[model samples]
Target: MSVVVSFKVRREVKELMDKYRDRVNWAEELRRFVEEKIRQLRAEENLAEILEELRKAGWSVPKGFSVKSVREDRDSR
Candidate 1:
């Protein structure tokens, strides 16, 4: 279940890519790059949604909370 995707590149860019045609699988390279970009974008979108929900609920930490918590955990260990 796959479809063809195509785009045009500058003439110089195409020439450079053609030079390495035997050493590279351009289709696979483009596919992996696109897949990785989509994953990164989705993760960012999810993070933004979570932050918005926290903001709406007025969620926040008091000043020095991180330092105090870290020191307490270190002392216990």
Candidate 2:
């Protein structure tokens, strides 16, 4: 069946979430974003070797760049 997980959050954050909750399904949106980021990080083309290889075949990663960001929860206004 289903289980419920409860926690607490800041007042301002809670109000912000309540405002946008109707327009977005938070669970589904969060799941999709995380899955895509993981896939990109673990791809086979990520093995950087030669100059042309790094440019055309493999992933070109920099010192610091990531799609993921900090997350917070909100309950009510």
lDDT of each: 0.98, 0.66
Off by over 4 Å in 1: 66-77
Cα lDDT of model 1 by residue, 1-77, tens digit: 99999999999999999999999999999999999999999999999999999999999999999999999999998
lDDT of 2 by residue, 1-77 (tens): 74554558899978988899999887677678878988887664454335567577766865444332212222221
Score residue 65 of candidate 2 by CA lDDT.
40
Q: How many clashes in each candidate?
A: 0, 0
Query: What CA root-mean-square deviation does each model show from the true structure?
Result: 2.5, 17.8
- Stretches > 4 Å off in candidate 2: 1-11, 44-77
Highest lDDT scorer: 1
> Which residue pairs clash in candidate 1?
none
TM agreement with the true structure for every prediction: 0.79, 0.41
